[model samples]
Each structure stands twice: as C-alpha cells, then as structure tokens.
Target: MTPITSFFRNLEAKCCAACGQMIHEQAESYATECAPCQEQASFDAYKYYHQKR
Candidate 1:
C-alpha cells in the first residue's frame, strides 16, 4: 500500500499529531490526549456536555 494509504489503514495505532505519542483507535473515539494539547479536548467536551444539559 502507498505510504498515505498505509497511514490511514492503521490510523488507530498512529501517534498524536501534536505530541508524537501513540494513540489507540478506541481512545480516539472517546478521548485521546495529545501530550502537547494536554486536556484541551477533555475540557471542551465538559463544556459541551454542560451546555447541552
């Protein structure tokens, strides 16, 4: 497979785009924390959930 295709195929095992840390596909669906981005996403989710309630 082409490098690009291979990348997407195993996207689940890919590292974080910002921190270069490994990320699981299952975690990605929920909350995959990028070392660099830290908890930014979790905070965002918290906000969204609270707003929706």
Candidate 2:
C-alpha cells in the first residue's frame, strides 16, 4: 500500500468538503466545516415533525 504521506497534499488552506468554504491555516488541522456550516450542524429535517408529537 502507498504511504499515508503520499495521499494528500500538505496544504495551508482548503475548501470545506460539504460547503466549499475556505478553512484557514490555523483551523485546517481540526476543522471539517467552516463557522457557518458548523453552527448549523444540528439541523435535522425531522426535528420539526418530531416536535409536533
């Protein structure tokens, strides 16, 4: 198998996989989603339906 180091580029910044937003160098190490996406991460379509029960 190829080494893990050869799999991905050592990037300073990259776009979010889900939302295509810029993740800066400081947050790239841990951030999978940007602030806007992260803030709304709990959004569920069934939430409103469940609440009515």
Best by lDDT: 2
| Candidate 2 Cα errors over 4 Å, as ranges | 1-12, 25-28, 43-53
TM-score of 1: 0.36
In the predicted model 2, the residue pairs found to clash are none
Name model 1 segments beyond 4 Å from true. Answer: 1-15, 18-33
Candidate 1: RMSD over Cα atoms? 7.0
Q: In order, what lDDT does every prediction score? A: 0.65, 0.67
lDDT at position 10, candidate 2? 50
RMSD of each: 7.0, 5.1
- Model 2 is weakest, by summed lDDT over 10 consecutive residues, at 4-13
- lDDT per residue for candidate 2 within 11-52, as digits (tens), equals 456778779978765632777877777667656545766888
